[model samples]
Target: MARTLKTQVCIIGSGPSGLLLSQLLANAGIDTVVIDRKDRAHIEGRIRAGVLEQGTVTALEEAGAADRLHREGLPHDGFELAFDGDRHRIDLKALTGKTVTVYGQTEMTKDLFDKRHADGQIFFFDASDVSPRDLTTAKPRVAFTHGGESIIVECDYIAGCDGFHGVSRRAIPADVLRTFERVYPFGWLGILVERPPVSHELIYANHARGFALASMRSATRSRYYVQCDLKDDIADWSDDRFWEELATRLGADAAANLQTGPSFEKSIAPLRSFVAEPMRYGALFLAGDAAHIVPPTGAKGLNLAAADIRILSRALIAHYADGNDHHIDTYSETVLRRVWKVERFSWQLSTLMHQFPENSPFEKRMQRAEFDYLSGSETASRALAENYVGLPLD
Candidate 1:
């Protein structure tokens, strides 16, 4: 016979988004169980986004998950844009009256994981062959394997934070779900080096050859990325070649002070904008990457995930505690309103920063004109500030 468990909420995956959602639901006095396939070590080892917008930080703090991030994270008032060999700075604090913090996703995940693990609010490393069914019925259940035996968990609600490749997205019925996506011709080849960053603020460099960004994870560990063909081989670019290309695109001003160490990790991420409608299809709710995704150029992935769960947590509380489904019923529409706006903003940022060999002269001129307006015009800068900092979440 299989073991049976029951909870008010069941959350899948243990990334920053899943773990944070779990903590918030737990703090709300809901009986929640979080399950992940990977162990603690592997979950914390993966490197991801490092920038957190002001609204996201505030959301985490309100939910009691921002203590460590507030303490250890480095706050930046602005970042820079390098174009035509000149650097232009966008002062986020001055323009928006808020600051964006630099704290790697790993650190945030580890903090939330540790807290949940200690309190025994999460049941991880016991997930395998998980599947959810009959979400429209009164009784919703997730079946999986644990300790070589079948396990079944029944919950009043389910949170699918399983990310882009996870099984949650596939479970949605094709006819009912509508998906919109735009795949880019190029992708980003990212690397993390064991040396101090050359600049104090992030530099978004737009060179004739390609696009490059100089960002940091810590005082000693720096993160960098360059645009590359969709199918470029990681092995083809040797260490020397990597440095040479990076220097060519982002090293004009700091030729002498720039020093790079051995690369600890490398990855290639394709740029795309994706959205799946009706985040809730009855008892099961989609959150984070399971719901929508934007290009990383705008640094909106994690922040958007955090925002999604804020709405989710509130709706769940209202439904279970007060028997009010008003918020729950409107969850999908409310979140997607912001989703489309972000999709537009992210697409604009990507088009402005990247070099498209296929673009016509008129298109190129329009991009340059838009960049110039954003760099010099105060009204234009404030509009950028509003989107970059984030829109208000109800």
Candidate 2:
């Protein structure tokens, strides 16, 4: 026999987007239930993107998740872009009046998970799956199983925060969906080293060979990535080989203070961008990667997801409190305005940094020339700064 429950909102996935949205709704006295297919330990242990834009920090602080982040994270003024043995620094404060903070997604997830766990307010059903049903009807449902028993949840509204591989996006009818996509020829091979960072600030390197990024998750944990052919084999990249490649691409003339440690985590992230219009269909609304995915080149994946939830949380609240569907009806249109901008920015960053296959000599020259222009031109650097620190949330 299946059990049934009720809430004002049903959120699938306990990621940053879902958990944060749940927190916001719960703060407003709205009942929300969040569920994820992964267990608490599994979710917290995964190594993902680490950079947090200034706007993301602000949002997290407002939502009370910044307590742990502030204590452990470092604030970075800007990043160094190196090409052909020449380096040019873009000062984020001078260019955009904002700076990005270095904080890993794992830490953020742990903070949000622990905060909710402490309050005992937001219900996160980890190691669970919630399925959507009857979206076109007045009463929608999320069915799942927990502890060997099936459970069904009824909600007035459903938030599809589950991400690209989630059920929420699939629940939306195909006829009502409009999608835009861009796939890249390369992927990022990343590793989390146990040693300290090689540099004080993050470094983005564009060598004739490929692109590399030097980043940090904590004072003791450094993160790094190098562009690779989409089909490169992880089997071919042993620990020694990985460090050698990284040093070659990112190592500078000056001693980089770099050290190699056993990489606790290693993985490849395929580059792609996607968005689905009208983020809502009937009582269901989409937020975060469930609706869009940006290439990791710009570090916008997690931050954009957070921004989507921030906007959707307000819309969901208005619908329940005042019965005003204005925001809900226009949700997709509203978010896409910012979404397309990020898409462009991510694409630009990817092209400027990565060495695409099948490029002609002229195209290669154009890429290097673009790099030169960005290095020397105030407008280009400022544009990168604004997008990197993040655009406005409202």
Task: Compare the candidates by TM-score and give the number of the best one.
Answer: 1
* Residue-level error in angstroms, candidate 2, position 220: 1.5
Q: What is the TM-score of each candidate against the true structure?
A: 0.96, 0.95
How far off is residue 70 in model 2, in Å?
A: 1.0
Q: By lDDT, who's the top model here?
A: 2
What is the per-residue lDDT of model 2 for residues 66-153, given as tens digits with 9 covering 90 to 100?
9988988899999888876678888999998788889999889888887777767545455356679999899999998887779888
* Candidate 2 worst ten-residue window by lDDT: 121-130
Candidate 1 has an lDDT of: 0.84
Which pairs clash (backbone N, Cα, C closer than 3 Å) in model 2? none
lDDT of 1 by residue, 78-192 (tens): 8887765666688888989988998999988888877887768747574789888778899998888877998888999889998888777778899888999999889988999
Off by over 4 Å in 2: 122-129
